[model samples]
Target: MKRMIAALIVAGALVSLPACGNDDTNTETATRTSNTAESTTVQISSVTSTADLGMIDQAKLAAFVVAFRTAYADLSQDRDDESIQEIVFSSCNAIADGATEQEVTKEIRDLAANDGTEATQSQAEQIYKLVTPACP
Candidate 1:
């Protein structure tokens, strides 16, 4: 199923993120002088941090939201934008943390189910399908 494939892909990507390394670096130099006749030069260097790359792609996230809302208008209409985003991010985080597809599906399902109406695996699958594309 699409859900299973998406979940597996997301899970794999997440599990591998920690093992990846960023070797890109940047260096800058600044010079300053004061009336006291003292001059100072400072050199700063930084490497791209994993945290910088850990975020989900914004465009993809937006697309996912649109797709989700279209697919599940009734469910999405009840939640605000922030709430939906939070759910997607939470699901992505779980995948990154090495949770299996079933685990991720169950988590989102439980969260959805708590909001007055019972949630189904199919709904969870749709959520997972929509969220996986947004993961960084």
Candidate 2:
């Protein structure tokens, strides 16, 4: 899950880079991307044989992943860690950007629906609870 989350953050960072424009938002985006890359490297080295991830504290992210796996075993068993991480981290980012719990839950539920799985509001709330403290 951490791997997935990291991957998503990295991808988002890359995509957020400025395009042929010199502006504060562009500079800010570039700085954010750089920081994200640095964090990802540090995070990857800290993990033992786990997938490289970016943003958030890895240990806490792992705990969230473990709990998520147990809570949604049937839906998550076949899903790769990276993808789950992506979903979780995306939600984490949203939370950081001021999205409400209900909004996050709806987003998570929607993501599950894409996999043909029906995720409960409680499950979504679990994600909010676990990722909130870990989000940087």
Candidate 3:
């Protein structure tokens, strides 16, 4: 059940990702950056608001989200099974046990600003809004 929910949330985020529009610049950059990311592993070191890492650790949280999305995309779209489970587990492990909706919302908002999704910020905002509450 948890996996189902997580997959749905990720699917929704992906669906919403394009709704807000992915510009050529961001697309190109994401493509170029993803090329070198083939062997990189993603993990979420801090999951909750109380964690000393805090949302203030924007790099951690942003990278976590980006990695999570990338892995999720790879699993569903690319159908790659080799390291998907490990990546997903690491992504889930990054979230602390007591994370709150507010903390996650703030994290999403902050990351969205620099993600080149400003033109459709509200859509990204909605995606995270749906994702945070469902976080395990």
Candidate 4:
């Protein structure tokens, strides 16, 4: 009877050990998941603010158009359609409330040069609203 009781106790201890280990692993996993979720939430909030500011402020938008035109003229030697479009879109989108024509032009030119393209007339015209209403 004494030996039987000892064996039963040993069996219980073995089972309980695994349970304790499993609990620790579960706790660690939960902690990691919670931290990951929090980080993702922070990133999402930052992206939202950035996107909100990405929208056009009309005056600055006009300046961006002017910049794109200037840059296009400067880089007309090696123009690519896709690159021009990209520069026009990116520069116009950068226009904020108080941006100047020179500032916008410089941005557009820099973007165009970096992307290896000249701004197209159509793309320039599209962005031109940020600077002039009569850009054809």
Q: Highest lDDT, which number? A: 2
Q: Write the per-residue lDDT of candidate 1 for residues 21-73, one digit (tens) a residue.
A: 44331111111112111211110001122222235554465456555556566
TM-score of 4: 0.29
Put down candidate 4 lDDT per residue, 2-80, tens digits, no spaces. 4333544554454344335477786886676567656644543454443332333322333343344443456534554
TM-score of each candidate?
A: 0.57, 0.56, 0.26, 0.29
| Cα-lDDT of candidate 3 | 0.40
- Model 4 C-alpha RMSD to native: 24.4
Error of 1 at 68 (Å): 1.5
Error of model 4, residue 128, in angstroms: 6.5
lDDT assessment of candidate 1: 0.58
- Per-residue C-alpha lDDT of model 3 across residues 5-61, encoded as one tens digit per residue: 565566556534533545876687667555534323222232232333322232233
Q: Kindly give the number of clashing pairs for every candidate.
A: 0, 7, 3, 4
Better of 1 and 3 by lDDT: 1
- Model 2 residue 21 CA deviation (Å) reads 53
The regions of model 1 sitting more than 4 angstroms off are 1-54
Q: Rate the local accuracy (lDDT) of all candidates.
A: 0.58, 0.63, 0.40, 0.46
Candidate 2 segments exceeding 4 Å error: 1-53
